[model samples]
Target: MDRVLSADEIRWIHDFLELKDITYYDVQVEIVDHLASLIEAKWAAGSRQSFEVLFFEVFKDFGDHQWRQLLGAKQKGVWRQVVRNGVSIFLNFFTWPLVAYTFLSFLLIYTFLLAVPNAVNYLQESMYLWGFIVLVTWGYVIYRRPAKRAFLAYDGFVTFLGIDLYLVGWILPDFFAIFSERFSATPNGMLGLAAFYSLLVLVILTFSILMRIKGVQQFYKTYPQLLITQ
Candidate 1:
């Protein structure tokens, strides 16, 4: 003889749906209640069936496939909202400052390089050392926080940009050296070159520190749960 679902069985279904995490709470509750009603109606029809059989039959009509469709719809709605909000946020908070900083920093670096051709060689070597340090530090930080995977990935990209800055600082001097040796007199000789490269090293170090601070701040904002441990 088929058994009717007990109160415990109904509660089990509700808990199972919750643990699955596929559907929203309200939707999962609705789905579970709907299934329970359908199963109750089946039992009321005088059918000889096990709870397992009734569960399977009802679930087949409202299981993974239906859940997948529901989840997809939910995700699409969330993404649409995200895009709408993201556009306004980027315009107000991020876009212009980022553009202005990038342009001005680039302009200053270029002007410095053109103005002091002789210091290029030492600056290049200093930059290479800084690049190695940044790479190693970034790798360590990312490995230490594997759980915050998305933020780690973003951090890694920023770390790479830091390395790029170091590389450019390193290469600019060497390029100037080759040009001076091949084409014309170097502008600032050995002592001046040392000072120039030292300045480059200082700038790179400062930039790296600033980037690390920003990355930490962003990581905290992105994964506020991480702050609990701190």
Candidate 2:
């Protein structure tokens, strides 16, 4: 018969992970299950091993990076999933009222561009403000929210937010400007296109954060013990 791990024993193992710097909730859940199963097996075999001894032994098998590698793995997984979800959302915009809305909005903007010389400037400012707002909001969420759960999703958002800020505020604009100048593209046209894409990128990033929030909600539903009041 396998030995059942006590609550205290399980908590002790969880603390050991924190000591190893594996603070992310998802990683904690994985390593805790792993340690419990292995420890139970060893206990059933009649080996008198201390939990601490077994715990360090398990961590030792993971090499020098320790449990920090777990964070990297979780971050990579979340990043890919967020990107896939964002692409799906973009593709879905081709359907229904979304398509109609997109077309009408572009038409309205184009008409305004013809009438208003300053329209491009306003659009560019809006794009910069969009990126800046999201970056700051996310930064504040991470700062003010006491980290009681996995930071993989939060860190993942911050990582892409940095890229979005750079792309919107500088890189993409410069790239498009270069191409526009080479081909003698209209300044307004290039500015409009750049702003449109920058806004699109921000929308995708916002949706990705929404998905992450939904995942966290589901996690709490599944493991009520892990739920922390927001």
Model 2's TM-score against the true structure? 0.66
Largest lDDT belongs to which candidate? 2
Candidate that would win on TM-score: 2
Candidate 2 residue runs with Cα over 4 Å from true position: 1-3, 57-72, 132-146, 157-161, 172-225, 228-230
For model 2, the local distance difference test gives 0.60
Error of 1 at 18 (Å): 18
Error of 1 at 114 (Å): 20
lDDT of 1 by residue, 148-169 (tens): 1233223432453455345455
> Please, what is the TM-score per model?
0.35, 0.66
